[model samples]
Target: MAVSTPPRRASRAPTEPGSARPPGRGRGLLARATLLLAVPAVVVLVVFFVVPALRLLWLSVTTPEPGLGNYTAILTDEVSLTVVLRTLGMAAIVTVVCLLVAYPYAYLMTIVSGRWRAVLLAVVLIPFWTSLMARTFAWVVLLQDNGLVNTVLGAVGIGPLRMLGTTAGVTVAMAQVMLPFVVLPVYTTMRGIDRKLVDAALSLGARPVAAFRQVYLPLSFPGVAAGATLVMVLSLGFYVTPSLVGSPQQSMLAQFISVQVNQLVNFGAAGALAVALLVVTLVLLGGVALLTRTRGTRSSAGAGVAGGLV
Candidate 1:
């Protein structure tokens, strides 16, 4: 008893290579907490977005004898076809214009410093904080026959030209509002590009423009793609600015949907039109997503190859 040995230590069980450990209690609690925190947002989204969208979808098929007559009518009707085409055409124009305008401005932002850069960014973002109605009306004032634009033109010996009540007017207004969306994405991409790469190209006897085209432009393309997709989609469904500054003939998909619902009281037609616009939007976004995914895959593969070579 006096010389009793120390109690034998318990041997720990060994875990096999594929054996799973018990889930951490803290991790489980954290996950539950995160789920609890997200419940409110989920509820709000379901109540507002999901519910209304589903209602619209249901109304599209069920209204006017629960048939696809409205869709058939949309396809066959000349007026509907014209509206859709005009919407698409204007969206394309606006997207292109925004891209052209944003690229240079974004490049400027990447080059500028301190206060000037801040000011440029502020200018890009200012429109978002302002009222949409105010901006639309401001465009109305500028584009109206005798507004500021015409006044400036008159001072230069050019007579007043009609800008308001035209497709061009709508495009201009849409571009003004959508410019920030394009600029920000491009600027973000430009900022992330390694300046040394361009410098290296310059040092290696590459011309500035050539280096930019071969090196900088490729890196910035994803941003351009993103911005163009955003601007195009927004322009497709634009209502306030287009309606305020554009003629009846220049009405977009949103205005058409509104007219069908408000003036014509054709719920079936309206719902079908809405559904058509939604489908087109989704299709476009899906195509953009596929393009982006392909670009990312190629980029990753290229990176892996370069890494392996290194």
Candidate 2:
């Protein structure tokens, strides 16, 4: 004969006064702890970036007897309009140039052996480790009249192309700096791509070029979009390269803003321009974010369909 034990008691969490402990309490505690760890970073951003940005925004309206006249002038003034247009045009050109050069190089990186790929990557990255001023001055040296670049061009019957202190010089310098940003993203995307899909396309009687165009190029759009957006946005506010390599006539929005601040002491106008720039940046970021999201969704759906077929 066996004796049955008393029924096992239900386990309950320790209760506080007038309340029972809730479910997922451990998770709640963990989240609070994580938030606590983030406090320093939040504090730093608030103290540094957020506060300064808000202050600037406040100055945009207040510094010159409190009106939106600064913004109105930006829209109406010919010189200000020209600078804005020039900035947009330069950023677009640099983005296109970087994309054109980066795609092939990134593809090369994907196709090469490990050693060669590392070398290529290092070539892309070495600029970051160098001084920006040094690089700009180096470009200046190469670009100046009677410099090594002109000398080479002179040998080739294209001597003294007048690249220095021109839009062309600014474009070249900006492109050089922005290229690595494009390459890194595209290479990362291309590296993870499934080449087997292209092989399958080829097995279906498609030519190599056709297979690549149909299979690989479309797959790399996310990275391409990301890199292009990065380069374009960064090129907008570029000051150093353009200031050194370009002239007053070639001034972009950043230099215009600088002139208002340093030369004219028009802080209100500068703040307005800065706010305008910040607005444009936010708009571009929002548009690209939507585009990338759509692309990502399409990619995911395509992958799911392909998996189902397999």
Candidate 3:
């Protein structure tokens, strides 16, 4: 009755939580793959952006007879100071204008039907479809003396304005182009807002505006901060619209940098101003990041309180 039994198969050991991964599934495999995928983009960025930026910084201090003379001029020269201040001022105005125009439009997008939302979204994004040059030129036409804008204004007894070479025209064009930047971010934030919270606020006898102010507005603020920062930074470096619509007297830092490059051929001064502008942009972005972080913390706390109420 004794039959020869087949040799017993070897039992595999169970993997423990802290155990090493199997050969093909190494612990760091995903990280290595991610690094591999990012290598090309990292190389491109270093070659293009980082290399040019380093050269620019080197030129700022070393070119055109060396020393810190170029940076000093940016700080001490009256023309440079004026242009720098003007650029900052204009950027602030553009940021404010974009935010003012975007906030309500974005809020509306969140409340509308799907089809209407699509239409509104397309409207917000229309500027991106056309070329920047084309859009700037279109603004040039509309902003020229006796152009549609001035003509409409004239009908209301406002005589043909010198809109083509004015800060106002430049502001209008800049705001329009920068609007979509603000709108898209704000809309995304608004869309994520819990409608039930607003309803709950209403049920608690809060006024419509009060509910929005207390419950919804705080939640949407990070988007506002992000959009505003983007618009402000872009406006600081804006050249085409301002150069096209603004006068030499109303020129911003970008135009000043261009003059140094193309007109005066002062590469050192150009680099210095460019560095200054870049520094300011970075500072703004950092400030916005800090603000958004604080706001996000507050928002999360508020959201938690609201959620508990629900």
Give TM per candidate. 0.84, 0.86, 0.84
Candidate 2 lDDT, 47-89, residue by residue in tens: 8656776776777778787977777777778887677778778
lDDT of 1 by residue, 96-134 (tens): 999999999999998988789999999989887899889
Q: Check candidate 3 and list the clashing pairs.
A: none
Off by over 4 Å in 2: 1-27, 301-310
Error of 1 at 141 (Å): 0.7
Worst lDDT 10-window in candidate 3: 3-12
Clash list (residue pairs), candidate 1: none
The C-alpha RMSD of each candidate to the native structure, in angstroms, is 17.3, 16.0, 17.2
For model 1 the TM-score comes to: 0.84
Error of 3 at 34 (Å): 3.7
Task: Please provide, for model 3 over 214-307, each residue's C-alpha lDDT reduced to its tens digit, 9 standing for 90 to 100.
Answer: 9888888767777887788778888888888788889987888888879999778887888888667657766666666666566763332222
Give the Cα error of residue 227 in candidate 3, in Å.
Answer: 0.7
**TM-score between candidate 3 and the true structure:** 0.84
Error of 1 at 9 (Å): 70
